[model samples]
Target: MLNLLGLDAVAESVYRGILDRPQDVDDLCDRLKLTEKEIRDALDRLSEMALVRPSTEDPGQLHAVSPHVGMEILLARQQAELASQKQRLEASRAAAAQLILEYDDRRADAGSAEAGVRYLEGIDSIRDHLAVLREQVVRELLTFAPGGPQTQANMSASRPLNQQLLERGVQMRTVYLDSIRSCTDTMKYVHWLTEHGCQVRTVPSLPNRMIIYDRKAAIIAAHTENTAAGAMQLTSQGAVTTLHALFESVWQSAEPVVRQARPTPGALNRQQAEALRLLAQGLTDEAIANRLGVSPRTARRIASGLMDVLDADSRFQAGVHAVQRGYLPSTPL
Candidate 1:
């Protein structure tokens, strides 16, 4: 049961045996029916993990650390490791973005464009490309509108094009953030779009904004923090197919906006569950906001609420409590 904390079967048995009563290697072997060698090995491993310490009064003796203290030590180690991993991931993202930019530059200098991947900068360029694609697309449109609520101007501007597409028998499906449920105008626009024969759904969060035209090409935000800065238009079969799969995966679990979705019994709601997962990943409120398409304040509130619910004093503690309560998987997802 304590395996998640780095304890194996023998180590856990040794821990339990010495928890309240410090046991020598002989006593442990006698109680656990293990060899003296196994008992000593478990003690050494436990000591290295800070779950057990040598007794000062008896040089050959070992005692288990308090359960609470041991757990805190293990949790702190996990949290540190998570923070390091998060840093590496951030660095990798930056590196990938740089490589894309360099590759695009090389293509531009060659005076010929690749057929598969192309980069477009500025809002006007993206809009122009979308307009051209809209006129040409014959089959379907799949989009992820990640930012929480649409602006009135954008909604008004999109209505005509959306109506035109729908009138031409295009299949349109969009997924938006669940936070839009609280925005009156956004909900009204969603209702209007639904009435116009578009299918719309909501999820707890989205990775980024994306639009796929006829499953042949996809446009994704070039900069996660500022979508207006640019976009990457991918026509590569492999990339487009992968994105389509991602959309389908999210769509299968998303709830339609026309009705409220019920949560599983004894489980956190999707939003809270997602928030806790992000919190455990060592994300800042701002980073959480970017993923969830909500303000940082909103992200902080959701995280704080989760901590309170778990009766945890810190983010890592919240994660530990969540695991203990079966709110999160023993192994991080």
Candidate 2:
């Protein structure tokens, strides 16, 4: 929809009318059944987007650019913005990583939790902190739930809070692992979230478990494999802002949760591509399974299937064939 490209319904309708034939303000108002002011406002927006231009024959009139040209312009602009955001995200990730390393090195020497970071020990402590933050949220909540499929206990415990937030009209966006598609209970909970106005999406993997409240505070897992081990609550502006940017980058690239998560025609699915990447790096099945949040057996099955598709006799051969077939953009090695 044009809304995805930042065009509202009224503006799109006005552009369509103008595309049919060059139109003056009066003509657009008559054709669209909109008031003169509305038509003029749409024209102003369309003009700024370069979707509309002044008519050559009648300077007072405005004309629509061809649909192809207009759409290409919009797409190109969006692509550039996405690329810039990605760069910022990468920089933020690097900076955050370095800062965390530094903080960890000095924590014992300086004593107490470092500025901008609070160490939360145990699951209960993390949950209690989240409860307090939940009550304080005034706007949006962004989360990364990377484990393959959520546990029933966790989902059940979260529903009431989720419902209250939805009722209060706060925006909630969550990203989960793509492997969740294989879990009925997880899918059911995802459907419930969507039905109640929360947006959910899935990706092949996530960096860690995280929940950012209002983009001003965030809690990130201390251990990627065992989040319950501990967590760090971050409140520093620079760190929180960086994590917020990271979430936005991931969210924009993630696919919405649906009945099926399909790959593009003749291309590898995200999971398979990620597996191939890891395989190329010579990771063991257990390691790959850990990263993917899947069982070792499932990881082996996926690897075997990929080998069969590539007509490869070994994992190394599979990686080679994947590259030759353009399944991978060259091995990370």
TM-score of each: 0.67, 0.68
What overall lDDT goes with each candidate model?
A: 0.77, 0.78
- Model 1 — which ten-residue stretch has the worst lDDT? 79-88
Residue 76 lDDT in model 1?
Answer: 45
Candidate 2 worst ten-residue window by lDDT: 78-87
RMSD of each: 16.5, 11.1
lDDT of 1 by residue, 225-323 (tens): 788988877777877776777787677767788865433334566677767767777889999888887899989898988887789898888889988
Candidate 1: clashing pairs of residues: none
Residue 167, candidate 1: C-alpha displacement in angstroms: 0.8
What TM-score, to 2 decimals, does candidate 1 have? 0.67
> Candidate 2's error at 161, in angstroms?
1.0
